[model samples]
Target: MDFVKKLPRTSSGHDTIWVIVDRLTKSAYFMPMREDYKMDMLAILYLNEIVARHGVPISIISDRDSRFTSRFLAVNARGPELVQETTEKISQIKDGLKAARDRQKSDADKRRKPLEFSVVIFSAALHGWYYMVFVTTVGEEYDKVFNHFGYVKCTT
Candidate 1:
């Protein structure tokens, strides 16, 4: 659906790459190209590479570069009936996407619950997130407490 141009020229003279993607299936194609190719040549390339395999697309989303816009019009003008079918297909895809989004939201709603809890302060002193008591008042602090819990000794 877009070109990555101005690449280091290959031995075959390709300096651009056309990156095409199918949104629904998430499949992609990277076709090498010459940067100087005209609109008509690009159109022919598209017909051969894309249309030959996947048929006409439901719609194309592009950045509206002049080359792409011209080619888009040329491709779209193939027939009125085809255009109408493409339009309907586009609408159907949009509706399907909306339905998928709604389903996901419904699933998430089923899992949603309010947080309910309480904090119990067992220690008289709150040192950072952990609660502990510093031992300025302890009679045998090292033997009675801290030493048994090694690293916890520093915390107190």
Candidate 2:
């Protein structure tokens, strides 16, 4: 999640956009907001727009913005060791998700190979038909032009 700031203000005085992305699903949400929104306002917006719709995320990744750093530091101060352990677990989960996604992609590609091959064959056939028609048309035009110029076919 991140913020895109310093945008041109809208008519309703919004000059920033909150960008929330789900890494696993590759889904995203963009919410317009005023630049001066406080941390509490941000939390409320986050709850309403993200949490309310998708439920709570397992982990959030964001840039080291002051608000995020302050909030994160405050939360982790209670159990720094736990934070380290959680980070390791999150990394393992991310790796597993990556492997799963890769396997899914490979399976999908295997399933789609026949369809892709058929599409290529169909396109080649269509192009070949068009080329034949074009050559035929050009041959007819050449004959007409030669006949107009008084050229005759000679028989031996």
Kindly report which residue pairs in candidate 2 clash with one another: none
lDDT of each: 0.75, 0.71
- Lowest summed lDDT window (length 10), candidate 2: 114-123
In candidate 2 the C-alpha lDDT for residue 45 amounts to: 96
TM-scores of the candidates are 0.36, 0.37
Candidate 1 accuracy as TM-score: 0.36
- lDDT per residue as tens, model 2, 1-156: 899999999999999999989876899999999989999999999999988988975556566554786687787786879889989999999999999999999998988633211111111323331111222322234345345644443322
Q: Best candidate, lDDT-wise?
A: 1
Residue 59 error, candidate 1, Å: 13
Pairs clashing within candidate 1? 1-19, 1-20
Top-scoring candidate (TM-score): 2
**Tens digits of lDDT, candidate 1, 65-131:** 5478777778777797887999999999999999999999999999977443432223223344444
Model 2, C-alpha of 47: deviation from truth (Å): 0.5
Question: What count of clashes does model 1 give?
Answer: 2
What stretches of model 1 exceed 4 Å from their correct place? 57-156
